[model samples]
Target: MEGFEIRLTSSKKGKGLFATKKYDQGDVILEEDPLVSCQFAWNAAYRYLACDYCMRQMHYPPETTSIMLLVRILAYIQQSSDPSAAIAKVKQFCHRTENEDAELVHKLLGEQFTHQMNTLREMTSHVVSGDEVQEFLTPEGFCTLMALVGTNGQGIGTSPLAMWVNSVLEITMSDDERQQLDLFIDKLYQYVEEESGSFLNTEGSGLFQLQSSCNHSCAPNAESTFPYGNHRVQLKALKPIMPGEEICISYLDECTLQRSRHSRQKELAQNYLFVCWCERCSSQASEPDCTSEEEMSDEDIDADD
Candidate 1:
């Protein structure tokens, strides 16, 4: 299903979408279709490029076919109607409706799309199967892929895309695999329950699908806790959300300096296409003011001299 449609706001960083209505904690944000509709990307990436332990893909591939394969997977997943796709059938597409920023986006998307194809393909081939990929691509691998693709400390660009891949791979339909995933999910749900009661509420049970949309922040107003059952993600409002707010969530829990946050955001933007211009991002861009005790002491000493 097409997820909630968001509109771009007027911001220096180009596009941002605000929630049109009040979204309670654990309320659904937009649900996105997978950009790559099959498990080939996940299986291939994990089997080859990523770390078996951490599942990180930090390098690129050399073969054009591998790159094209990944690109084709991503291209096929795009709805024929989505404006972003060059698919002629797409009557409606995202445009720089408000800003000249549209032009920058147009260029950026093209480059990023091309880069994704190349890098994903390259990353796939570089992994020496036994070194990075799991023995069976079991449920743990599945969830790790789920987490990796969703939002790790970096971002959630791959999770939605990977869901489409899982759907194609029939990862959920195989009775054995389904049971494994179910157990894992159940375990996660339990973890959330033990940690915080508010994370998984009565109305939010099946909303694990929405976990793919939660972004990360150093000082987030929202938080997600994983309980032991159902591998569920429980969302909680750390601060009160106003009506029509974007319903922010954190990618990280600890306090980080502005530069550190920017570094992570940059990683997300480079790896995923979207630039996060969240509250932390804006603060990070500005230079810090001079207000040190050392500076004050030096001033006093100079005055005495």
Candidate 2:
């Protein structure tokens, strides 16, 4: 949290985060930890040992850590972290059942999907309350969890190794030195790929308190990034944000952002379960609605003739 004194304002979607002080472009607005987080299933399969309770990976610099902090530790951690707190802060997040992700629903309904879910419940039953675990086992509860994560999980992507490589390439170097360094890096990557085939962008997602409160806008003022190369998310202003302006983030990727409003709405509806009324969409409100921008272009050409 920086200059922005916050207001939890209400909207049809739920709540929105507003800034009480202005932020310059590239200024960091906030940094926060997640309530819970997990790496991509495929990423986890890459043999990165992480804490069972917190999801802190082991590949970083040497520090004492144990993956043995199981579901029991989850309950203990939550309880001990606050003790007197009645409701978990994560409960403030939107968890509408209708927002259950399509892919998540398909995966959960799969025959093999419930094996880990069932096993985890069985193993943690003694420590976690039966009622709590039982609710999560139900379809409605499952949907709620999926919806919460789907809607609020701010994506995190950072690689310290990749950053170091970029830093080395940026430094001034003689041609021969640069050539030798490039050759060494090529050989290093060859060895790495031999062991781990096709390493791609590290996709890490987390449920953040402040980030979850920020609403989506097709045109956004702020962005969430993992600059420190970990789960600690830093919200940076994409433009000069005014004192009273509400902070918004883009849910759609670059290609989707360029599409017709109708297409954008479809994407958001499918993924986020809401109609957008952001400024970008509002300006195009009077335009003839079509599925794709190309269709609109065709119609306009016909009209011009």
Candidate 3:
């Protein structure tokens, strides 16, 4: 909100962020904390642990993914006396299409919800007087949460000692006495990683009310970064911008910039449910014609984490 303002005009791309004043390259536009954040589930195959809240990488590996975070959010909503307000906020996000390739996204969301419910039931089955499950846990609510995450979640990167220590301790220590020793090793590793300057942790995903308003542009003028160690993220200017210019950011990886117009548009459409009409896309289209079937190199495809 420092250098930008939200414009909700119908002419614009739904809700979008716009510059309030001129900004030079590298100027910090806005620094904001997330409305909600969850640590990513660690994948044994990938051997990376990201923060549940900010998606920052930890010392060891991630054990729970976004689905775990979604379960946490749902539990919070169920415990609330009135969850209507929270549901209303989630409903604001755009939902994925049912026709998308193999219905993968839809299927995954459904599966994760079912898994969470079953896990909760098993955990509490032995309890004599467990709380009754909330009635609001429905397919509609699940889809709404998924849509909110798919559309608005921002990937943050940072190094936090507590996240690293807790993750490492959880895996290494089973008793209180051993936990103390594990903590020491955790602190030592953290210091080593920091001193080596080789740490690039993907802490977790977060939802931001202000940053989410910025739409995607292949040639974006603004870039989001997590400079602060906590959940705070900053949106910085990538180039000079005049007042009233739409402050855009790239939803895909930076490598997408090197891809052809056809490739970029296809990726955007499939993943984001939108076609690119930005200046870069337009300019590329006007250039030399290329086959739509041009194969993307293996390097162009980002490895799934």
For TM-score, the strongest prediction is 2
Worst 10 residues of 1 by lDDT: 200-209
Winner on lDDT between 1 and 2 is: 2
Residue 96 C-alpha lDDT in model 3: 44
lDDT of the candidates, in the order given: 0.38, 0.64, 0.63
TM-score of each: 0.35, 0.68, 0.66
Stretches off by above 4 angstroms in model 1 are 1-5, 40-70, 73-240, 247-259, 265-277, 284-305
Q: Write model 1 residue lDDT over 135-230, tens digit each, in one string.
A: 113333322232233222222122322333345456437788877776876676577557544231211111122443444444565655432111
* Candidate 2 lDDT over residue span 1-305, tens digit each: 36665465655866788888888899889988766555554444556665543444423211011111223224533455463331355456766644344344434335454564445445545456543345543545544554465566666555555667788999999999999999998987788678766544344566677788788899999998776656778899999999889999898877788888887886787667789999999998887678656867756885684
The RMSD (Cα, Å) of candidate 1 is 16.1
Could you tell me which residue pairs clash in candidate 2? none
Ranking by lDDT: 2, 3, 1
Error of 1 at 295 (Å): 24
What's the TM for model 2?
0.68
lDDT per residue for candidate 3 within 92-175, as digits (tens), equals 544444343124344444446456545543443332111322332344434445555656677665666655555655675458
lDDT of 2 at 164: 72
